[model samples]
Target: MAYCAIAVIVVLMSCFFNRFRPLGKMLVIIALLLPQLSKAQKTVAPLVLNNEQLPVLPKEFYVAAVTDERDDRSAVAWLLPTTEATSITPQYKVDIKYGAQAAIKQFVNYAIPPDKALRPVIVRIKKLKLAESLLAGGRVEGKMEVALSFDLKRAYDNVHLIDYRTSSIYNRIEGQQYDVETLLRHTLEAGLIYFNTWINREADTNIKLAKGVKLIFTDYTEQPEGDTIYYSAKRPLRWEDFKAVPIGGKYEASVLPSIGYNERVEIINGIVNIHLAIKTYLPKSASWVRNGSSTNYSLNHEQRHFDIVKIIAERFKQKLMSEKLPVDNYDGYINVDYLEAFREMNIMQDQYDNETSHGTNSYAQQQWNEKIDKELGK
Candidate 1:
């Protein structure tokens, strides 16, 4: 009896050990792979290009990037790394494939997948040896093997694009072979440029697509104490305020006289509540100064611009308060009034600068300052 019991115990122990052994090995393998696989799990964001460095993209077209965000439209794309880069880049270069998405969207609107965007445009690259015979003069010859494939199901109905693996691409530079980073960047820029050009030619017969502004909708929630609601009359302007970057031209100082607002439309107690506000700001990010010689004088000119914006905003507020607005179409109604007020502000601003000659005309500047003060009081 004792020998039989021992034999049964041995068999049970061996089975238990066999199960735990594989589990232990799996844990070890997972520990080893955790770091190596981290990059695969991480998401790459859209590429930020220096607008100055970018060549003029096809007139209105853009390259868009696929993101984790829920897209209501089709044809979004992501970039992936399929092979080890022989190129010396710490990171890959990619753009928002907006132009491609836009082109695809025109054709495959409802057919696109609802749960996720299209397949990633995979990029793979490797290096090649230098030519046996080199050009004696200034030319240095180099070559590279590259392949790319973008899913056209994104462009077509249930059609997969080319195979990145089988697609053979060769690029040779007459100059010296560049580092992996430069090579990758050059390839990306060139590839996107060519892709955009092709899409323009064939993608749509929708009467030639023209680039336009994309609309973004913001959501709002109720807060107890503090919320961002800018009211023009409630806020005023100040000097010694250095904000706003000067770009696009050579100027000493610029006053960004602007208006911005948000609205919260909610139902409370079976009644519709629309909370809207418009106000002006003097921000330091977009304004700039080239010289301090005329700082005080230039500041006054900028102040007038703000004052003009304030005047327009106040008038806009009053206009809204007095009118009977329809709940369903309230947004459109408000925007029409808001845009009209801004158009008037623009005309006034142009007149202010033209009459003052950007503050060169001392007489006109003083007269305008007094007029603005009187209107601000009203």
Candidate 2:
């Protein structure tokens, strides 16, 4: 309770020392919060980042985050027994502490590349407390606070202290209106958003999983897919997936197939483990139409475009299997090869459109379909 009270004090006076207050305020707050800790504690195992979901955040700079600072080993950031709610979608069992460490861990790991994740940098999170206030109209104002203690060589970590916070007021009903777990998840996101603005690059935590089950062009067996968006063009493209605006002249539609990839290297026991992946993205929002006259024909043409990207991604993956990059500066190493391959892919995409006259040349379109299929087969 004392730590919770300290969190409230920090939040209430956050604006007081916006410039230099964070440093001195922490010292004062910690001194006051030690007496109110609850004796009984609950523990939930730390949540682990999925191997594929994790990336080497740095080719050079590495990190391993530590989220637990509680002396009692409890993981629930803040617990409230109030069950008054209007709705509860998926009710988390009452009295059980949800794993807060993993919640913020998931938030941070997804925000950076693999190299950075492995950096010696330690992001120690402490004093994560949540509080709520009853307000007008039976509304409840929830406050989430996390004291982000880090030796971030980056200015984002300052002597002044990096305090993360987010709050919201929601309509209160009865019977645990909604899952507090869900709200807490959103709070972690908001806190990270505030933390990243000055500390690291901003990132989105709500990105969809990047695998396209039906359209894989290559077998990705050895490496992990960290931030890749993989799609297969072999199966064919449905009319529903192409939603990009058509800007090319005289063409009713355009399928902008994108092949993207990234590489990471870790010198584990002097043996460099190269983690690389290449995948295709079929941008639904950026692809659209003004005509459905030749829907089937146009779709086939677009499918070919997508297939071409898959072919390139497959080729890129193959290149990684054989190529040996200089490890002196891994961050700068793979760029040379991948960038060239990317340019070649774009060129081939454009060449197909030009030779087929945006699918108007039926003979050439048929020729391209066969050629790309043959290459893909090989």
Candidate 3:
């Protein structure tokens, strides 16, 4: 019984040693790797940007916002090329003094201001990375890539104006890491100087930088060969132009005429030029006359209606030519003026018909004919 008990104890001790043997090996391996793992994960100190290195621009611009849009925002550069002794790689982060966004903003603000009165712009840092590779003969190669976009800030949105991309390559001895900051500062300065030169050249002619609006009036004229007749001082209305079927109404004759405009916009020398082509037209298919009422007198009254439309078009042109339109909402102001002119056309036509009783009142008709002719002569 004693021998059998000792045998059972010996087997239990062996099983316990086997179970704990893997755990002891794992602990030893972890202890050996602790120092190397910690070193591999270590980060170098952040870079510092030199503000005095930036250049002043000819035309100042406001830096409204700055954003870092790189895919990996955690690190801006990788430091310490792999050597035979140490193969671990370390990352170089943003500037410790100002960080990425703040660093760029401060650099730009040194040359310009944050004032809203200046030309406002936003800067996007698309790519900012510095990479190093160990080369033969104890030399290290450093390459930097930087991409930036400039946008103009408007009332409700932003307009992209320009883009700049640049890359630089340099060679140095293994321990010369200070070139990273110098290279970064010089590259940033180059981008700003490029933008400044571009804006200075473009400010006078680019539509996006227009400061005011201008109005140019033109009369719409076309060949008198189509179904539609464009109003002209020399082309008077004839009785044969009426082609539509006469509707059943108390009036003996009817004419359909209207006023409208076509617009063409162009910018010249930092001014928005709005060209308006005024059109006063009569559609022959929509005008009709009773067979017996086609008298010179009755025709004269219908022509006066057409003349009323032309006069209103002239008045519309005068109104816009006399006022200063805001550049931000010039189209809206033009639409308002057009609507007012349209209402005026309707009221004037109705008043003429009401006073003349549809051309039956002889004295009133005669008075309208003279009034219409006088306005047209002007």
Candidate 4:
């Protein structure tokens, strides 16, 4: 028994040492090499732009922007035009004709010729070179083009329902000498990030489907007879070519639902005179107002409204696809899609009323019931 115990102890020790010897060696090596490896791995992505690096853009880019010295004490600039000016409702031919001409003339300082009066003005602009100075600190030179093109607003429903009350310039409106420059930098950074995010999402979707979607930034512009800005994929877009247009929020011109076949376009001072043809649809049923207090919950509710709408749209589309229904089945229901969309919209509204307002199902339910009754009657 003593001999057997000694032999078993020796065997256990041998096995333990054999297993731990390599592990100990690996730990020692890792402890010795980790810092060096980390140092070696410190590298930057090639496409990333440093603070001082200038972006390469085309030379012929022309940028048109608006300035409000009071709002942010900075100038407002956009790759797109002013949203407010385009919101001019034109239900009549005279309004459509003269309104468009007036808008174009205000910005471009040119008359929309009677013969070419009906064509949407299209423009394209890009950057020429980097503008470096004590102020800019050797940043990418800002450049862009203003184009006027198609007014598809006339073809789509709800063109005038919301009334393009949201007027904003793409540039920051602070009066500092570097305000515009700063605005340009911010716009470029934000725009690139946004596009990259969109690309990433598209890539993920494509990979799952075993397909790909290639989208390049281009400065494509289209303007027909009057004042139209048409952009396409063929044009090369520079970092400064795309301008950010704020569509909604506090101090917005108006909130309008973008309806079928129509999109309201805005440029800094560009002309796009189209009329609102449809009557505005009031929320008679959904008594859910935006959260009154400026708390995070209120903000969350507003954001949730947007998020929920997107989710509902996706779900509806998925349903349609699963049923093998053509996208055209609801073509006739474009105007009425508002009704269907609101079906899910109320969920967020209810959440807002409950969580944000802390209302005991009083105001929200009452308002919601009214909206429902109105819709049902219609």
- Badly placed stretches (over 4 Å) of model 1 are 1-240, 243-251
Prediction 4 global C-alpha lDDT: 0.29
Instruction: Please rank every candidate by lDDT, starting with the best.
Output: 3, 2, 1, 4
Model 3, TM vs. native: 0.71
Query: Whose TM-score is greatest here?
Result: 3
The ten-residue window of minimal lDDT in model 3 covers: 81-90
**Which parts of model 3 have CA positions greater than 4 angstroms off?**
1-43, 53-56, 60-75, 81-88, 113-118, 133-141, 171-173, 223-227, 233-235, 243-250, 318-329, 343-357, 360-378
The lDDT per prediction is 0.48, 0.53, 0.78, 0.29
On residues 32-105, what C-alpha lDDT tens digit does candidate 2 reach at each position? 54432322112112223232222223332233564577553444333333344333322223211335565556
Model 4, TM vs. native: 0.19
Best by lDDT: 3
Cα RMSD (angstroms) for every candidate in the order listed:
26.4, 22.6, 12.4, 35.7
lDDT for model 3 comes to 0.78
Error of 3 at 111 (Å): 2.8
